[model samples]
Target: MSSSSPSLARAPHHDGSVTYLGPVPTRPGGSVRLRVHVPAPGASRVRVRWGQDGEPRLRDLTPTPAFDGQWWTGELPLVNARTSYRFLIEGPDGARHRWLTAEGVSEREVSDRSDFVLDASDAAPDWVADQVAYQIFPDRFARSAAAADRELPDWAVPQAWDEPVVAAGGPVARQLYGGDLDGIAEHLDHLVDLGVTTLYLTPVFEGRSNHRYDAVSFDRVDPVLGGDDAYRRLIDAAHARGLRVLGDLTTNHTGSGHEWFRAAAADPTGVEAGFYLFDDQGYHCWLGHPSLPTLDYRGRELRERMYGRADSVVARWVDAGLDGWRIDVANMTGRQGGVDLTREVARGVREAMTRVNADTWLLAEHFFDASADLVGDGWHGVMDYAGASMPLWWWLAAPGARPHATVPLPIDPLPARDVVATMREVHARYPWAAVTASTVHLDSHDTARFRTLAGGGEHGGVDDGSSDSGLARARHLLGAGLQLTLPGVPALFAGDELGLTATTGEHARTPIPWDARETWDAATLDAYRELVALRREHPALRRGGLRWLSAGVDHLTFVREHPAGRVLVHAVRPRPDGAAPRDGEVRLPAAVLGGDAADAVTLRGEGLVRLDDGDEPVLALPGSVGAHLWLLPGDDLAWT
Candidate 1:
């Protein structure tokens, strides 16, 4: 079986086709084997190139007699923090059609012109772990009623809030809700009060719609949302308030109206042809969506212009004091069987970011299994949607939904044991130091609002609809408490803290009703504040290993063990009906319930409570509809 045979089973490819080749415990100046799978036969020549910027280095592979169809491996000498490179399958007559490039090039194009390989030593910046991110949808956040309402820009038409979010043809909802960067700057104090350390803005680059995901120009900020100066001012204002801001970067595709796309569409072989996937019939769009045309990263000039070179769009933004970038659709970057473009892009981004700010964070928006993509020294971390968050939602909100639930009616809450076990497995698989920076949230712009999922009200309905406010608040508190106390970072969507319930998509993205603060349910906010304060006060809750104490269908309790000198016992209950009071003593692990050796414990009616013993404290088990976070003191003890 030659390497080109498609039937041959190949080893699973790493995150983005890049491989880690070195001693298990890597040391500086060591040597390792770099292996890649090429499924082609009759390959006479294989060429490899390795070097850093402004340097030429080379190597060639001799064919192994009767080579198996499996992976074809190569050896390379390792040097600390050096940008090395390699390419296999050189001649056009060879059967092999695939090879890995340090520059994320397509198989057809492999030359010295490609960008430099990423240095594996680069990791995600430090600030990412300690930061709290707040996502802002520009249009829906806040409107400056005082400022003149600008006319609808090109490719955008104004419509009422109730209108559908269709494309250019339909009655599109494009009303200028007036929320701009200046408005965001004006409300920095409010963000500070909410304890946000980072502001993750939706794409502010030049675009037509409210959501700027369909970018027209990566270099320019949208004039409707404020221009480059406005962005800089916003960044400055946020910095003044001790906040960091990261702009969204959409690299997978661009708007059809983008200059590059327009040029490519006009002439198939134009200068911009390499920038897009153009054929006789215009440029290739994503999923046939005319508005978004995919970019062809195979072109050396395109990669260098967009991601390479000091003056590249990515580098330019970082140089402008932008904290970092949130890469959109990261998993979709690489071409099939070619170098993982995302890894290459991430490398360029990392280099550029480190050059600008060593503490800059690189957050990728990947909505799939990200363990491989996030690890392997490619990115700091992706938006963690799998490990901690999805499970919680499945257990709490859509329990009756498939895979987890077995019966109809109200499904049983996710077992506390299962939650802890899943958390443990995820932690074991992805250590906190390596892949812990995650944006844990109930909902974002992509999904239905948390309140609506919690059965607060019907979609497209008025506020008169009733909600399980008290029950929902309790659940929200429990979720928020766990989120804050968990190992990874936590993110709270705007208006979620104030218990803003939305029945429709537009409602979910509506501006924060500051006036409603006095009238809206503040229980969620209060609980979040308390949890945040608790997390801040206790080192254990901030950074600690979690241990499950007791868990059942109705009640769940766990403890956070900190290395410093603190422990926190947290508990939550779902049953609305109170637990029957047990007259006999309830024995608990001394680490959890830190009181005199009581053989039996008494339970009151339905409510949550926390008991402090010496410095250590225990959160008493809540009977129904409540959550408790108790601060504990003294050395951590093992719990069974």
Candidate 2:
């Protein structure tokens, strides 16, 4: 895994990119062609070791002449629902060989758990790879003039658009900024301008709080957020602007005030009573919170009402023009104590949504490790906080300001190598389709702002003046570049690009300040625009396989390879001690780049200069906070 040697960089790379592996989502009993790059001074013989009929089998792979002798390939039958395989690179001496698996190259045998996977059930919608998503907290995004006429519920404490957010103490959830669906519809132009293809609203169902995770009803939109009619209009307007909208649903529980909970609490013999778990003690609430009642999937009636039937909540929303659903607290949706119905609930949701919209996306919000539930039979993708966000946070966190509350133990700053290692380890656990479909974010509503982690001060609260510092802006933009260029859908929480800051998740919900353009971070916004445009402009960034080129304490480099192109990215982080930055150099292997240094061309970057040393191209890294990208020629790199 060391980047000091070019041989390590060329150590037999393979991934599920269409350019490398295919017949994607192979059917049971079908054969799939698998390929791997074997650097020059080729292996004596290359073979694929796969699990077949509960036994390990090896099949020889010959040099793929179409790839100019640098690539080796063969076929393997996917006889099981989930087939696991790895490459065996045999050296000239029969006694020496290397195992190539998802965990990277190894001289000794590794566990099968690290093997590359192909699942018959894992197929994401083709459109997923091309999306850039924006997350919106509805209450703080924007509000239309119509919101003024609507009556506020008893739980509401209304605030002006320009009023300061109350992050703590009194009525955090009750303080409504009056942002409604019609208001969101009116702001479609801003999304289009931002170059996002999808908009993800946190929960929109009628709830008792401004942050509508506690839903009082699932059948209708909150009347205060302009009702069901406004919801439809927003979806229509979004679709017209070529933007897809995803709704958030809390399948694990509902507000204690929800009609089903209300009905069940009133009558033990009622059909709705079976929908919840009750004992002599009382009904179960999510995380023991009295205001949020948990749903029991053991009851068939609850399943039918939630997602089993055509009239179910899952079906109704997808049918109502939601392009997809972002299941809230998805990691805990179906299990309580010894009972576990997580997969069942996921399958039910997927099936119900598919019945109404075949292309609808089913994404889960799992704050930690979610590999056990990402078998592809259920959610197409997850929020991927564990795989992408957390690692990035550790690498880029400000000194003494690691604010993620989920981690039970304290975490110190991580080196760039550890960051890439964590990402690879987590990403390897799922099928390639799921990996590509997942969302990569820096921060969300559940954690501290990424800006705060990148040295924007203690918190991103509106009153937190650190949000506007030059160093914070530079580091924040660097993190954004990394997010967009990675091999997944890049999602931006609302107001992040505007340089909005908060000390915690609740405080991060600062209004967009639409009327106050002067308050916006114009530089950060412009950087976001440039980064997203770059991602959309290149196929490699959007739909490619990643290969790490180098990793150091302050510099991380990688390449994204696709049939259409190849992009090499080098991200540099500033030193925390404010010392002069060192020059980090990454060498590009000719075997991997498909040619000599003459073929590589610089795209756009800061403080970077390319130096060619014969067959290998060396990238002179920038000491300051910035990201550089280069386009390597792909004409000779194409595979059949």
Who wins the lDDT comparison?
Answer: 2
Worst 10 residues of 1 by lDDT: 1-10
Flag clash pairs in model 2: 459-502, 459-503, 460-501, 460-502, 460-503, 461-501, 461-502, 461-503
Candidate 2 accuracy as lDDT: 0.82
Please provide, for model 2 over 64-87, each residue's C-alpha lDDT reduced to its tens digit, 9 standing for 90 to 100: 553324578788888988888999
Count of steric clashes across candidates, in order: 11, 8
Best by TM-score: 2
lDDT at 282, model 1 = 62
lDDT per residue (tens digit) for residues 55-151 in model 1: 6556764444221222335655545444446565544374444454432224575554332233345455656656777888887666554335665
Q: Give all TM-scores, in the order shown.
A: 0.71, 0.95
Q: Rate residue 519 of model 2 by lDDT.
A: 66
